[model samples]
Structures are given as C-alpha cells and as structure tokens.
Target: MIKKSIVFAAFDEEYVATIEFKLAKLTEERASIEFITDAGCLEAFLERPKKIDVLILPYGIMLPHPEAFSKTSIYYLTEEEMDAENPAYIYKYYSVKRMLEKIDSGLITEAESEKGTKVVGVFSASGGTGKTITALTLAHKLMKKGKRVIYISTVPYQDFTYYIDDASVLGTAFCYQCSINIKNALKIIQDEIKNEGFDFLPSFKNLPVSYQMKFSVYSQIVDYLRDKNIYDYIVVELSSELEADKLVFLKNCDWKVLLTTQDKIAVGKLEALLSNMLDFDRNILILCNRYKYNQPDFLSGAQLLQKYEFSEFIEEYNAPLDLEMTKNSQLFDRTILCME
Candidate 1:
C-alpha cells in the first residue's frame, strides 16, 4: 500500500481550518497529513516539512526571510497579498516553491555521483570513546567543504542529532515500526540518493532479534548503494556490541574506522574486537582519542602498535576529543577535520 503525506500551511484561521478539513478528507483515503499553522510552530514545521506534499500558504502574513519557504510547493492567494499591501509575501512563496520544484524534478533525471556525497562510518571499541562525536566531526568537516552530508547513528541514544547545527532528522529511528522490511529499507535509501542530493539513513529503531537473519538484507542495501556510486560518503555511527553479521555490513564500506583510547582496558577490548574479525579489511584505521602526552602509563599509538603485534593492520591517529569545540564548530556552514 502506498501511503501519502501532506502539509497544510496558511495564515487565516478559518481558511486554515477549511484546508485542514480538505486534508482530513484526503486522510479518509489513508493519506498521512499534518497541519502547520501559526499554532504548529516553525520548529515543528521544519522538523517534518517533507511530509507536506502541497503547502497552501495563506493570505496576509509576512515572512522575515525569503529562504524560509524553500522546502515545499506553494499555493498563494494571488489577490489577498495585493489587497493587504504585501505582494512580496506572495512573490517570495511562489519563487521559493518554483525553485524547489526545479531542483526536485531535476533530481529525477540527474546522476547520483555528480552530487558529491561523502559517507564515513564511525565505530569504536566500546561506548565512551566518543564515536558519535567523531562521526559528527567527519560530517561537519564534509559539510564545511560545501558538500551535503547525512549523519546517522545505529546506536539507540543517537546523540548525533544534537551536534548538527542546521540539520533535521531524516528517517525515523523506529524504521521497523513502518513497513520497512530489509528490502524496502534499501530501496528507499537508493531512491533518495537522486531525490535528496544527499541524505542519511539511521539504523532501524529495533535491531532485529537474530543478527544472522539480517545479513541478506544488509548485503542487499550495501550492494545497492555501492552499485549506484551516488554518495561521496555515508557516515555510519555504529553501536558498541559487535556481532558477526554487523561486521559483515562494516566490510562493505570504503573505510571502516575504529576509535580507541590509550587506556589499557579500552585498547584491550579493541584488540579483542579486531582479533575476532579474522577477515577484517586493511582500511581499518585506529584513531587514538583523548591522547595524553605526559601520562606514560597511557601508551602512545605506536607503542601500543608494537606491544599488541597489530602494527600490520592498524594505523593510529592521535587527536584529543573536544566536545565543546565539536558542538560550536558544527554550527558553521562547513565541516573541518583537525588532525593532531
């Protein structure tokens, strides 16, 4: 069954209600619709603007920025704005909608790779190594390059959404709540490549009960994405508990980065994780997060490399994690990579 979504936008209270009534009629046919009036608040509107297929901007209200209306299709009251001496309001809405339609339609025929999306997946030995922070940093760095990035986290907490300055959550975390079988999930992702220019798909809300059962689905998704050659990169912030099937999913990436610290406990767990993956790829990069220069007890990456007999497969990077800097810098119009 094809489920439809709609957004209702207008200023006049009675007119808004009338449109809502019409939207309700559409819902009788199983359309998923939402209303965005002065009451719905801008944050709420922006959070789910795509749900609105047709946006009916009402008469008489003035907007502060022309850019605000760019996310949807617009229908304006041609004479209502003129009568109220706010022709600019009508003009702005029309302009924004027209431009969005142009880009949206162009996406249908456009090639995916030309759009330039970079995706990087961030994994860690355990929970506290700042995996989400690192993933957001990679995304922020790419966005700064004037490239589009979609940041997604497989972990339940999903702190990635907190770091994005002007970002919106793309798909629901509880993907399984919908009709998201493994096949459909992969299809939606590939379909969005040309449509959204660049976007991210977070892990399903509930990890399937049996890891082995999910592989065929994961493989299908990865194969589709790899074959399309669309995104410059897709960053996956992985969960801590490493499973065999999940590791198979990791191998599909261009780079499967693992973050670790010099703490004996941390490095030990990372070693164990890598040792278990006998077929681990060569591209695995070991990042030493929160490096301490003076603490001799805390081994340097090279020293750890020599001690662990992992000098062959692991390349270490020393960079201290700065949470505050990550938060503030993430807001700027671009993404930056700081190597120490």
Candidate 2:
C-alpha cells in the first residue's frame, strides 16, 4: 500500500505554516505533507516523478498545465464569500480539524449521495455558560445562512422547549434505540423528525422523563443523518454534567464549542478540560459569556470565537425565551462555523 502525498502551496507562510504545524502534531496519517511558500519551489516539487495524491493551492496561484496531473486531486483555498459556492475552493481560514474536513469538502456538500453534515458539540465545563442557548442559536444561524441544520439536546431530563417549539414526537428516539437494523432506524428517525424553523429530534414526549442515552446511540444517529445527506450541520448540546473526564464521545464530533464565563470556578473547570484535550486542542473553540467583567488570568490572551457581556442575563430556564427576539440573535453568522 502506497502512502498518499498531500501538499499545500500559499504565499503567506505564517498562515499556512500554522495549519501545517497543527496537522503535523495532530496524528501520523498515511500521507506526506509539504508546504510550499514560493511558486518556484512548488514548480520544482511538481517536476518530481513521485506521486502527488493531493495538492492545495491559493486561488491566485494558477497552474500552467492542470491536465498534466490528472491523477492528483487539486483544491483552491479562499477566504472570500463568493468562492464558497465553488466545489474546488476551500475556506482558507479555519480550525485545523475543519481545514482537514474542507480538504475533503465533498463530505460537507448539501447534495445527496455525497458525504454531508458536520457535528458541532456544544459543551461547557461549568454551569450557566448558556451552552444550550448557544447550541440552539448555532442551529438557527446555520439555517439562516441557507445551510440545513438539526439541533439535538443530550441534556437527559428535558428538551429544548425554551428556545424551540415543543412539538412532541412521542418517544421517537426511544424507539430508535430499540431498533434492530439501519432500515428501522432510518424509518423511525424520518417518521418523527420535526421542523421547528429548523429540523430536530424531540428525543421524547414533551414530559419530565429521565431517559439516559448512551454515546453509541448518538453516534448511530449521526451516521444515519450523514447517510441521508440532508443536513449541513448537526448542532449537539452535550451535557456538561458528563464533565471532562467522562466525555468519551467527544472525538465523534468534528468541532467542539466550549462555552465559559469569568467565574473563578469555571476557569478551574476549563483547566481540567484543557488537560486531556490533546486530541482536539485546535478544534476546540472557546467563547466567553459576560466577558465585560474580566477574563481568567489563564485565558487572558487566548483567541476567542465570540464574546458577550450582556447587560441582562437569563437566570431562570423555567420560562420559554425567544432567542430570535433577543440581542444575541445577531451574535451568530456564517463565520461562527469556522473553528479555531
């Protein structure tokens, strides 16, 4: 078995260098990666007789003879919105994990029969970081951006009735768990899917039932959704109660958004969470809530995806609050999809 060769060419060494550094440490994949900053260097490398399985280049760097490398998979990197619709172009500025996925961009296309959907796990180390709100808002934002999105809250005891409409599916997810085969699973999921502005699984009847779900069940659900190629993103609200050590299913997600606050205890929890994050250090996006107060000394200079210092906080979850009517609705955009 021959190893695949993956090469990246870009004028900005600093930008591409960061990606190279992250992927190198990510894992020892079955590929040889070379980053070329100079066009002459890339030209000389291309002159080699060795196999070039994949080549990623910026849009401005045109290839004189593209047909020469018929066997090579070429992709263009860009940051502009106009280029997003192109199949050959990938978003240049993205998290390492997301960048890799964009390298295989076919997996996230909306077209059926293609590899589709990205799972975003919204998690927090401490309470009151508004993790659930962030997850629901992410789904809404992605939907508004013309991408298909589904929200799933794995909080166990209750559903996301506060942020979304509570049209019950009458224990559809429970039947899915008991399903024996993929056909049954698909039929059960499709039969019960509810669209509350965006698609979502109601998990259970709109009741205060304590139903504990395993990570394997969630994994199967993700596989089923990806198999259908109907969704662009799956926003999962992971329970913070699972904590850092017990988050065994974290790796299943493509991106993990960890919400935090200026609270001292939250900082300690983040420190613990960051300790075992060797696998997804670059894919973990940190967002601060009530950031007007202050940042913890540890994350003082860290690059945050977004920040909020709301003048008013929703202290109670007993009432259903309409997030679309709130100021935070403007907090999300297509840019929020980017990791790191």
Q: lDDT scores for all predictions?
A: 0.49, 0.63
Q: Candidate 1's residue-wise lDDT over 1-340, tens digit each?
A: 4544445455545334323443344235445556565755744665544434445455543444436556545545443224334322342212222322332333122222234333355788676777776776666555444455655556645555454443444355234423446665564564333212325554343344422224445445545565576545667777787777667777656566677767788878877876777566445656656655554434354443542321111122364444357544422111122110
For model 1 the local lDDT of residue 333 reads 15
lDDT of 2 by residue, 1-340 (tens): 3556788788776455346645664424545678889978877766662468788888766676767778888888775544666667876644555566656533232222235688888888888677776788778767766679898776765546766666575465545453345455556677677887788877555332333345556666777787677888888888777543337566667777777776667766876766656565545666665454333444454333223111122223344345665324435332263432
Q: For candidate 2, which ten residues in a row score worst on lDDT?
A: 305-314
Q: What's the CA RMSD of model 2 in angstroms? A: 10.4
For model 2 the TM-score comes to 0.56
Backbone clashes for every candidate come to 15, 1
Model 2 C-alpha lDDT versus the unseen true structure: 0.63
TM-score of each: 0.47, 0.56
